[model samples]
Target: MILHGIGLVLLAVVTGTLSVLLAMALIRWWDAGRGTRGMQLPQGLDSSLKPMVLLYRDQRLVDATAPARALLDRLSVPEDEWARLLQWIGPRFPEAMEGLARIDRSGRFECLGQSGTGSATLRLLVEQVDSGLLRITITDPQAEYAGIVVDSMSQQAMEEELDLLRRSLDQTPMLVWRQDAEERVTWANAAYLRKAEGQTDEPIGWPLPRLLDSPRPVPGAGTRTRRASLNQNGAVFWYDCHSHPVGDQVMMFALPADAAVRAERSLREFVQTLTKTFADLPIGLAIFDRQRHLQLFNPALIDLTNLPTGFLTARPTLFDLLDKLRELRMVPEPKDFRSWRQQMSNLESSAATGHHVEEWSLPGGQTYRVTGRPHPDGAVAFLFEDITSEMSLTRKFRAELTLGHAILDNLGEAVAVFAPGGQVVMSNRAFRDLWPGADSLGHALACWQNQPETGPGVDALGARLTQPDADLRDSGLMASPQGQLLGWSVARLTGGRQMVRFRLPDPAQQGGSQPLLAASAG
Candidate 1:
């Protein structure tokens, strides 16, 4: 019994010790798994994948893996732009998050951050060494790359604008051109090269000095400038070509002085027509502007002034011309010119309402009756009428009256007097001699003279007056009492009077003077 009891005690002690050891081991295992009894669990686990941190200058955002947040932080967006940037890039790069997740899954993530403000480069670098420890790296692109993109866009816009400007210039009516910095012609519009006066060549991009030089046909004295060239073809004219520096090149534009000139041949023909039609218009016709500067002169004015066409340029002002006239003894004096201009001004002012006339003296030994009137615009027209012919005609008519009455009484020609109503008042001695049988005063001579076909003398006279542009003067020829054949001429006068004269035909053959082609049918 004592031996069994001792074995039991030993077994109990063994069981208790084993139990304590086993319990200690179980506690150690539990402490190892859930931490020690007094120890605490870690706040985070050491894993291959970890959330990434995005950082700007002072801004930071914790997002998915490094690549995902890296792209956002690469934009270098401000804190305020966080939500906006995510919204913008999310739809734009839908696979961007997936890429970042894969980097996390692969245990290799790149860190992204803004290196400098407004930079396009994304700084990327590996922040972790372990493959599964959420490796992080930084990604960065050079700053010049952003500048290149901006410059490219600006160049594109500039090219488009330049092209539009060129097209606009080409479509414009006025001549337009462009030159490079080297003064070389870069572009010219179509109108700039077209022949304004039917010339066969284009005139654009010509050298600065060459364009201004006078053509070979140009008169040296007529050229107004040495810097600019002058070329004229009919109505085409060019002048005042001047160059000015623009950037590195020069630009120039000019107009021909003869641009307003049409062919003078039409004007010359008109002058000739006027001279033929109004042969008695003794006074010259001229046109002057509001400033009393002569613009045009008729043939008579040209003759009277004896001035060349260059008078417009040489004598720019009327006063200057008046001074020249006085020097040449063509005008009286400067004072007279002043008075004439004053009167002309008054006439011009009045001519707006009606025509005006005045009498003025010339430097020569004559006076002119000047009439002035307004044109449609600011121009004034002048007409001069010389009364010298009318005065002479009046004097001659008075002297011829006495001779005319005597000739009418004794001539043995049929004569008749009529009032404005065509009533015959009396017959002449010639009528009494020829019709001694009947026919008294107040008889209408139409009874015999109108029917001159009954007379042989009247019948033969009709054939001679058949020429065009000639007046019918006689019916025929008849022998007088002295056995001399008389041919009659008739003509109408200014008033209601007709005159008839008789003379021998072929008087030269008869050793006598030729009879005058008398003025008849007065």
Candidate 2:
């Protein structure tokens, strides 16, 4: 009885100690549940922890945190619908459930999802915890991959298009260039460099404004201006430049002025057409310098003067042609020709008038209606037309009207008649006046006529019989007793006889040189 009683007392002591240890363990576990920072969870226990979720089903989704409400609104799901989603999500939730199962079995899951009109992917995971419920994680993989693809495609297309644009720009004829916001040239085509035309030894990368003495201003983001330049050789050109903001740089496009080129070409064509129109005109056109040197002579002038075409190129002086005229007996005399040419040349140099028109006595003894026009640069133009045929017609008309006898006897025009033997048969009042009572009528023509046998009158008569258009004039002493100075002319009458004219000095000046004589004998 005493041994059994001792064992029972020891058992009571052991049982009491076990109860005290159990109570302490329960208190410590409760403290850990309240989250003691010092307590470390086991590895497998982390999968069981759950976030503390506060549910308020009656509250509007708008009342939730911005992020949470935004996510819900994007899905077009209301708060009540989400709160009661367990029944409505029967179909779509299966896919989410399957993904969760796989995550629980393998610690991670990846699956695709179709949300509204778009598609997505989910990477869900269930993490283990030491003491809490399981954690469910979801992420979208489709959105991430889609963003990467879009960025890659945009970069590739941009590079391809830029390559094509660069090639096209190089092939263009006009210069093209681009500049940064700071007005620094960033790029240019091959034609852009060619415009420099090797004059510039340095590379062309600086701003265009820096190259000119006066550059146009480039205002920022407003109205713009452009201008053109002329080359050293009198060539015209154009440039168009603009400035605008483009990201961190200013974009500028420069091109030569094509419109200016077209305008110039059109103007040149117009001038060419005008010159061509006048080239074939009928009247003689001649251009002369201040020294009476012929600068230009149209085809008509060449033919009328019997001048060689080469004379047009060399532009000979009036004296040159006058010398030839003297040799041909076309001038009254070489001295007279020289004097008259000098007078015309002097008139041109003095700029006596801006323009004038008058009759010209050609060395050939032809009367030409001429127009003289003066230019600011000391150049002159002479236009002429022959009126000899018109004068002949006028005389013929007078003869038909029975006015020839009256004109021959009373007209102030000097007149003389030559018999077949070269004797003077009759003379007019004007002719007697010129000789101052000299007995010319019914006398030998050689007594008063100047160089009766070998003078301008003889030469003119010979040419008139052979050549349809012929003339002569000369200054020489008369073949008379006194050898007086005389100017003479000869023409064929309608009946085929010869009518002559003689202009002599008055008796008051018979022994003196005549005042500067100006006469036309044709």
Candidate 3:
């Protein structure tokens, strides 16, 4: 009996122990299953738990739930948080604000989002928390309960975009900033911050330093730009600041314009130099643009054309300038106004194509040489030079040469001039009649040697004319094939030239030649 009792006791203890172990196992299994069910609740319960709620106090966001905050983070606006919310929800629920206003009296109100295909229907619930506070809840029943999956995806995309924008703004060399309605700096990019920090050694704080002194009452709507200068480290840096209005705020951008400023300064200096040079030039210079407008002129042009200083400075057209010259009697007179206009047109056309030159003789006995040259970009330049003195001198020299030739032709002697190179320089009419076709010294010598009575006297005359540094004067006599007595003399002239003269002894003067015969007899 004692053994039976002990065995029963041991069995009972084992049964109790096993029962306790089984109960603990059942509890753990139940807890695990309950936990899993809790993790994935029904869609309705899930939506209720993850509500998007926003608490606002006098149009200012005081508190917001995680989901509501996440939604606001996706919005990109320059307005405050409450404004951003209203702007985003207004499109979906046009009567959202009116409903909120009536919520104080109605206690609560619900707004259904506009119905659209392929989009989840949204619900906006507004309730008065107090006299000055309101609570707004936004829900989408049609959306699936994706838990953190959808949130993570949306958050990732937004984060990537935010990162891209941040990097771009920071890397850009331009200074970018945003200001509120009261002109308080709300946000600025990295470049702007750096510049602010450079202005002062102190650490930059809120309301970033104003790098550019933009005009007041910032322009609304369209972009307005102006140049601003900043002194950094004792060096002046120029920038082109562009401002644009966004809602009640303004976004400003400043681009570096140092290179452009330097280029413009250089161009101005170069133009000044050219103007000074043109002022001193003797030739009248006029430059006309492609549109036939007088773009540039020199003082010499005024002096030569006798146009008023004010008229030239007024930037007259080509036709206007020409008419002014005509009125001043500076241009050559034409038969009629019609022909003059046509001539002017032709002159302009010819000048644009290539080089053109024309001479104008004024009634005042002045001559002008007008030259037209083509410039780059279809421009034309005209140069006027006074050549009256040169023309007069040329005419006088030509008259003197004519008189000399006439005097030689009337003389009884045939005269020919030879250059140092033995080439015939000039001959009179008498020389041509005496020695037909003797156009050159060599030809004339051959002709003289062909004479029937030619002797050593002819040879001696040729030698005297051909030899360099010969006697200054030489004379001889020769008889033609017709027995005509020809008296020849060679004389040296200036510039190493020789003049040879052949004279037919006059019968009246032949008796005077007897001394020459007696000398020959001696």
Candidate 4:
């Protein structure tokens, strides 16, 4: 009876000790539930250091840190309750369920999610916990795969957009290429291949230098644009390239610029031809650009304007050029020095409309015919011709005419000159006094003819004057108003003109004058 009682006492002591240990275990579990820091999770949880959310095994949201809640809000997921959050995440990322399966099987996994519009992306790392809950940690984007996560539901739309972009790049007339950091071509569009001219089989994955006859190194980062030429099937082509760096790759956009190069070459050739032509021409040629600076000048321009070629090539303005000409007495002097600039402005305005022409008569008896013509691109060209010889000839001709008038004025006999057209060209004053209204300088021969008089004198004079091969002389007397005789003679002159003279006899010598007239006619 004593041994049994001892065993009962020991049992009671052991039962009390067991109850106390069980109570302590329950308290520790409750502390852990309240987020005790010292308690370690199965996945080595960093809950306090990073943003994290805990999910129950049934895919229900349980607890989240403040940062995790903010992150969930940013992802546009519901944070109000577990059921609502699950519903939203499941529909948006159907793969999350698949990721959950992976986590259940593998104990740890990752999930990627994209917003509807594709702007925001969320990466969630899920780990199985000792408490049978899913520990989801939001990791940085730079971890494994560097990209944004977008919903695959709109993947078709995104693919369509990418295809459109590709088509646009392909159909473009320009050349496009994607290259690596070593300037090795990884891809080229149709335009770029066409420019290759079938010289190479395929240029993909080849050094960019091998694509050209004499390839140069790719431009450095500082110079992202450049121009180069290529020889394709014995023909030359030019290109302009622009580069954009994308991480380790470079996007190269090139344009076929053969046309521009050819045009520039043609322009240079044409200019050279023009320069040679102008070099031989006597007329002075000067071209000024829109800024009125002298761009081109021929040798004649220097000679005519008396300006040095060095000065002209220094690029003088129109006003400065004209002032230089004035200083050298090559151009006419301006009456008002202050208004000369305004005149130059007017000159340019007029020249632009069409052409402005004027004769500049200098004080040194020199004349210049200056023509200002407008050219394309708002340029102006001036042509200058020296007309000193023409002016001198004109002055000499006028002087001879005046001398002839003076010589004819002093003659006493009544004389008249008739042109080949039977027009009375000139007559002495005595002829006007003798014949009242006949051959008075401007009258035609018809004005003086007296109704085709049938006298021998008239007949003979008409044949000599009208017939080209007739005799050169005709002289006779015609009856005057008072039955007196007036002697007249017609003779051919040098220039197909007829000279006619009339003689009036004195009364005492009237009988002898008739005999003299008959003798002269014979």
Candidate 5:
């Protein structure tokens, strides 16, 4: 009986100790749920009942209600929650940051947000719960009580989209930034920060440095684009900057333009070189574009055509330039103005397909050989060359040749000139009649040797004519197959040539076998 009673007492003591420990645990938990650093809420407000409330310890997020956590999770930034939250809120409520800065001294502050279409007015309440803890409360009194509910699939898709946008902005080579009305840089992408810092490994701070210097302020409406340059570590980098206004601020983008700038400079230098070359040319050059407008003209063109520099500089059309030339009497005169225009049109059409040349005889007795050639891209180039001296020399040569031929025809004796190669160089009319078809020296010799009435002297005549250096003159008398006495002689002329002559003996010396005196006289 005594042992059973001892067991019942021990059981009662154990049960009482268990009940006391359970009560202490409940009290500690209740106190922890109230707030941090012994903070107490107002009589009618409960933290669990509030939809949007965030608790921060210094720069780190300690806890947040369901709706507040959802909002912070939607922000796509590499920064901590506090920084991301501030960035989103500072742009909309500019004074909010200022209020938070003074929160320590004032203990608490409230900011009223502007209401928009289908949205309630926001109320932001920031309080310093303790030295190291801060509480931010966001509320909308006119909003209905609705739960922040999102399906798993929808949440995943939104997260993926946000990640893509964030990655794109960070990885793009272009520099991008946002600025407020006061010209303070509020946000910048990774590329912008890297260039602004210039090879520094230091962490980027808020309010990024401005790299582009604009002469004028960014316009408020429509996009404004301009060329800008940045100097980094003594190296100059060029960019084409574009700015667009977003509400009261501006968004700027800078695209690399170094290659474009270099290409444009090279083209300008090439054009200048060509212009200098054309300026020094002797031939008058005029180049017309596909539209037939005069695009380029050389100084020689002005001197040759006698057109004023001011007139040519005006870039006249093809017809207009031709009309000006007509007025100056630089081109050949046509019967009428209409025919002249049609002729010029034909000249342009012909030049487009191939080379076209026309000779212009001016009133001043100057002749110009005008040549038109096709250029690349449907352009045409005209070259004017003065040919008056050339034409005069050609006419003089033709006249001399005519007079010489006339003198040769009047000769009474038949004459043939042979080149060093024994081919006939020239034959006069008398020679052609005497030796009806002897076109060469060999043929003429054959005709003479075949004659039955010819003497043995014919072979000696042939040998002398064939010798290029046989300077000694030879003469002989022979009878033609037609029963006429003929005299023939061979003489060497200048330039290694032989001149052979055949003539009928004079009536006074016809009967003598003594080689006719007529041959000796020749």
Candidate 6:
């Protein structure tokens, strides 16, 4: 009987010890579960594959992984009650909120959200707990789309945007095309077809490098522009292609530049012709564009300005040209450099008016006439003409006239010359001494004042002498205003010029000669 009692006691001790251990273990497990909200953290989740964030029923942050925090910056949540938070999300993610109001229901949603970082397309999973708490979870990307069809506004928006972009690309003036990684043309716009159909209609399915004489602007270059030329139907065309890479494919936009190329060629030819024409011109030609840069110059410019050949071909500015000229003593030297700079600017500005004329007396005893005239498209042209001969001849003519007057001053008798019109051609100092108040040269004969009041005045006599059929009475003797007998004789000279001379007899023999001639005649 005692053995049976001891066996029951041993059984009781074993049961009590087992009960305590079980209770301790249950308490430890419950304590651990309290911190984790009674849910296992899904042992060893692939965090690298997808970030995750969990929310409590109280709308408090429960836990988040590394990438989850970065993504949460994009998901805006109002700091309010859990119900209100769910309501706020309901409008934007109505599908995600279907079971949000209930703790026992489960729901899933995908949405596009905006935050500081940019746009974020995310997914939300809502799960219920036995403790009446909501377990909200977030993942960056949802599972692959299955049989359940879900269309969102973001998807519609992307499709509409893509459609609009396609339309815009078609309407654009440039020829937009896409090429595969092999550099073969796959698709093209209408502009590309219009340009490529010049000789043939097969642009697609052709390699871009074959169509061009040279493909790629530079080898091993990144996305950039290249000028390409093609010959089709006996015509050459040019295109400036803008290229960029789009994931193993190249997107190219070709701009039509054939007209621009032709225009440039025509301009080049025209410039050559102008150069040839200006080569033969005797005048120096220098043309400056609107920007005040020397564009065109002729050989005569070098000869006139004494500038070096290389200096002109170097494409110098107007100011630079002036500075060099001043250095070479070719142009007028400026007293002050600062003031001359301003003056130089003014000269160029005014030269565009096309009416500027200036004379430059160079240091080499030469004179130059510089003229500036405006040309097409706001250009200025300077022409230098040598006028040294013209100036020298003018000076010589004046000197000879002065010398002739000096010689006439030493004469004794008074002399006068008249043209066919009775106008006094010239009168010298001898004539002026004979008649103190006689009219100067070119004086009219109709208004003589200091002559004798005979022969119907000097004007009538001169008129009769010059008449085609007048009495040849161009010579006669007349008394001066002082009652002196002056024997005047008029005779015709060369060039339709007539001369008048006065005779002053010897004072000792004049009275006896008159009476002797009279007695011999009797």
Q: Rate the local accuracy (lDDT) of all candidates.
A: 0.49, 0.52, 0.82, 0.70, 0.79, 0.65
Instruction: Report the C-alpha displacement of residue 491, candidate 3, in angstroms.
Output: 5.6
> Clashes in candidate 4: how many?
0
Stretch of 10 with least lDDT, candidate 2: 48-57
Error of 3 at 275 (Å): 2.8
Clashes of 6: 0
Q: What is the overall TM-score of model 3 with all chains considered together?
A: 0.55
The model with the greatest lDDT is 3
Evaluate model 3: give its lDDT. Answer: 0.82
Tens digit of lDDT per residue, candidate 1, span 22-87? Answer: 999999898798755456534443221233334322222333443355445545655554464555
Q: In model 5, which runs have C-alpha deviations exceeding 4 angstroms? A: 1-148, 199-205, 214-221, 375-378, 396-522
Q: What TM-score does each of the candidates earn?
A: 0.31, 0.29, 0.55, 0.54, 0.52, 0.45
Candidate maximizing TM-score: 3
After best superposition, candidate 4 residue 476: deviation in angstroms? 7.5
Give the clash count for each candidate. 36, 16, 0, 0, 0, 0
* Per-residue C-alpha lDDT of model 6 across residues 454-475, encoded as one tens digit per residue: 3332443446455635665665
**Which window of ten consecutive residues has the lowest lDDT sum in model 3?**
147-156
RMSD in angstroms, candidate 3?
20.1
Query: lDDT per residue, candidate 2, 1-522, as tens digits?
Result: 999999999999999999999999998898888777557666544432222122232222223332233334444544463443323223433565665445435654434434222232233334532122344333344543343323221233356567778788888775555555455657667666666544465665454422211133344545354554535335555566544555555544455676877888899999778567657776778777777788766677655556667756787776676466455544334256567677656545444366676565556557666677786566777776676676678779978756655666676457766545444566676766554543433233333344323334434434443343345432222322344444555676654446666555456766532322221122
Query: In angstroms, what RMSD does candidate 5 have relative to the true structure?
Result: 19.6
Candidate 2 all-Cα RMSD: 25.8
lDDT of 4 by residue, 1-522 (tens): 999999999999999999999999999899888876555454423333343455565566677766556545645544455555556567546677787766767888777665433333556677899546888665434432443343232343366467778899889998787777666778888777666646667653444433532233444633366777777678877888777776677777777888889999999999999999999999999999998898988899887878987889899998888888878978667788777667767777888779799888988888999999999999999999988898899999999998888787677567888888776788877777666676433342343345323245555555666774665557766544333456778777888887888776557755434543453354
* C-alpha lDDT of candidate 1 relative to the true structure: 0.49
TM-score attained by model 2: 0.29
Candidate 5's residue-wise lDDT over 210-232, tens digit each? 78874334454478789999887
**Number of the candidate with higher TM-score, 5 or 6:** 5
